[model samples]
Target: MTNAGPDGRRIEEALTGGNMEPVVRIDDTVRRVAGPWTPAVHALLDTLVRGGVPEVPSPIGIDDQGREILTYLPGTVLDDVPPETRWSDSILQQTGGLLRRMHDASTSLIGGGRHVRTWRSASHEPVEVVCHNDFAPYNLLVTADRLSGVIDFDFASPGPRIRDLAYLAYRMAPFAEDALDDSGFTAGEREARLERLIAAYGVPFESSEVLRVGADRLLELADFTDARAVETGRTDLPEHAAMYRRDAVLLVGLSSPQH
Candidate 1:
C-alpha cells in the first residue's frame, strides 16, 4: 500500500492524522487534495512563518498532480490523548500558549486584503486575526512530552479570537454532556482547566463569555454537520450533530449567570 520514489525513498504513505481528508506523506513532505481556497491557506502559512510563529509547516506550491504540498511535521499527532495524560496541565498550558502564538502571528494578516481571500470557512465579523477554525488537540503534534507542531489549515479564516478559543475549550476544558466527558476531570476540575487555558492564552474575556460563544459554535457545527450528512449520506454525521446540540445546550447552562 505504498509507493517508492525515484530516489528509492518511500514516496507515499497514507496518513491517518485527519478525518476530513485523505493525506499522504511523501518523504519529508505531505500532500492532500487542494481546493480553490488552498492558495489563501498557503499565503497564511507563509505569513505565519514570516511572523516568527514556530512549529507550523511551510507550504510548498502545488504539485503536478494538483495536490497541496507542505513540510511534514514528525511527531505523534495527539488525536485523543490517553486518559492518564489527557487532563495534564502541561498539555493544556502548552496548547493554550501555542494557540496564542498562532493568533498573535496571524494578526498581521487581518485587514490586509483578507476580505477578498478565499477560505473554506466563512469569515466572521470583528476579524481580529486569522482563526484556525479547528484548533483542538487532534490538530496538534506532540514530541518529547511537549508540543512540536500544528497542522490542518483548511478551515483557517478571519474571525474573532474567541471563536477559535471556544472550540479548544470545548475539547480541552471539556464542556461536554456525561456521554462525552472523557477528559477524566470532575466538574470543578474541568472549570479550573478552562480558566487555566484562558489565562495561559492571556485573553481578556471572562470564561463565561467563552462558554456562551462555545455554545453558539456548537450550534453552528451541528447545522453544518447535518447538512453535510444529507449531502454525503454519511451515517456517522447525524450522531455528531446530535452530540453537538447536546453539548451546546450544556454550555448554555454553564454560561448562565445562575450557574
Candidate 2:
C-alpha cells in the first residue's frame, strides 16, 4: 500500500532535515505519520492560528495515510550557528520578546479544555498556557537578525509560563556550566542574558528562579530520554540523555554566581 497526500499525490521524499518525526515533504506541505495525540495537537494549532498567533506553522488537513500535514515554513534553523551570530545579546533579547508574545497569545488557551499527552512533562503549578515545551534555537527559524517563526509544537502541553521560559532560558540563555565555552557567554554575561530575557518577556521572575526551573527541567529531560532509550532499544539515546544529566552538574555550579 502506498501513502498519498491530501491531493492524492504520492508522498515523496522523507525530510531528513528534521531531528524528529519521519516527515516527508510533498509539494508545498510536509506530512508525517499521525500519532494518537496529533488530532489534539491539530486542535491546539488551530486555536493558535484562529487566535492570530504569530510564528506558528499553518496546519493543513490529514491525508488518507493518516499523516498530518503542515505548511512548510522557510528560514534558517541554526544548529551550527557562528559564535558571533548565535550569541548576540540583541538577537537573544529579540527572541525572548517573541516568546513573550507567544506565551501571551497562549494565555488565552488556559482552561479552554484543549490538551494533549506527550513525552514532555509539565511543571506542577497553575496552568498558565500550553507551552511550545521544546522552544530552542534549533526549533526556531531565523531570518537575518530576527526570528521569523517558531516550529515543532509536537511537545505542546500545559504548564506554568515560567517553566516554558525556563526551558527557553536553558537553551537560549543557556543557564549551564559550559555556557562560556559552548555559547560564548561569560558567567556574568549569562546572568545578564537570563535577566534580559525575563525582562523582555515582561514577566516577574527572579533570574534565580529561571535557573532553578531550568535545572529541574534538565533532570526531567534526562529521565525522559532514558526511558525512551529503553523503550526504543536505542543505546545512543542514553548517551544523549547523559549529556543533559551532565548539564545538571553545570547548572549546580552556577548556583554560586550572583544573578
Candidate 3:
C-alpha cells in the first residue's frame, strides 16, 4: 500500500468500515476514492465548513489522483469505543444536537441535481433538507468527554428530517439485533434511551414514527443497495438484506409506546 502522490505524501491504508471503500490517511488529511458526483458533494461539505459547523469532516479539495481530500478529524469513532460510548447520555445528546445544527445549515443550500449519483437516493427526493442519510455510531467520532466529529459524507442526499433521524435513532439508539456487539441494553432500557436522544435532538415525533423510521430505513436501504448491486453487477450488500429483515422484525416487535 503506497500513497506516493504529488504532495510527496505517503499514505497509509485505513481500516475501513468492513467494506472496500478504500480510504487512506496522509498526515492529517484523508483521501477517498471519489465518483463523478463527489464534486457536488464536496461543495455541500464546503458550505457547512464555512458556516463554522464543528464535528463535520470538512472537505479540502480533490487530489490529482482524483480522490476527494477531507480534513481527518481526530477521535475514536463511536464503534471503536464500543459499549461505554453507546451508553453515555452526553454522547447521545451531543450527537442529536449536532444533527439538528447540520439540518439547519443544509436547508438553505441548493445542490442536488438529477444527474448526480448516490446509492442512498436514486432520484433526488423532495427535500425538507438534505439528510446525512447514513448517520450512525460508526460515522460519529467521539472522545470520553465530548462528541468530536463526523466522517463519511458519501451517503448524504436531499431527504426528510425523519428519514435521517430515524436511521440515526436506529443505529445510535441502536434498535437492532447486535447493537454494541449484543452487550448493550435491554429493550426497556433502549426505549428510554431513545426518548432521551430524541428530546436532546429536539425533534417532535410519536413513538410510533420513531419505531417506523428505524425499521423502514433498514429495509429501504437494503433494497436500494441490492438494486444497485444487481444493476451494476457490484456486490454492495450480500448479507445485509437478511440482516435488515431481522432488525426490522426486532423493531416491529417492540413497538410499545413506553419503556
Using lDDT as the measure, the top candidate is 1
Worst 10 residues of 1 by lDDT: 175-184
Report the C-alpha lDDT of model 1 over 118-173, residue by residue, as the tens digit: 89999998889899988877788887678888899998999999999999999887
Clashing pairs in 1: none
Give per-residue CA lDDT, model 2, range 1-259, as digits (tens): 6668899877687654324667777777878767766765677777777777656778898988888899877677744466676777877887788777777776665675565345234445677877777888778777776677777777777778887788888877766443446787666777788888989888889876777778788898889889988888988888878878888766666654652
Candidate 2 ranges beyond 4 A from true positions: 1-13, 16-19, 112-124, 176-182, 256-259
Q: Which stretches of candidate 3 lie above 4 Å from their native place?
A: 1-9, 18-20, 110-120, 123-126, 180-183, 225-236, 256-259
Per-residue lDDT over 1-259 for candidate 3, one digit per residue giving the tens place of the 0 to 100 score:
4457688768565745522478888878899888866765776687677766777878888889988898877888687786766658788888889888888787666455544434434434556776777788778877776888887878778777777787787877677555645536776677787898789778777766777777878888778767766776775364666778888877776675552
lDDT of 2: 0.74
TM-score of each: 0.93, 0.85, 0.84
Best of the candidates, TM-score: 1
Can you give the lDDT of residue 51 in candidate 3?
68
lDDT of 1: 0.86
**Candidate 3: which pairs clash?**
none
Error of 3 at 98 (Å): 1.1
lDDT of each: 0.86, 0.74, 0.74
For every candidate, C-alpha RMSD to the true structure in Å: 2.6, 4.0, 4.0
lDDT of 3: 0.74
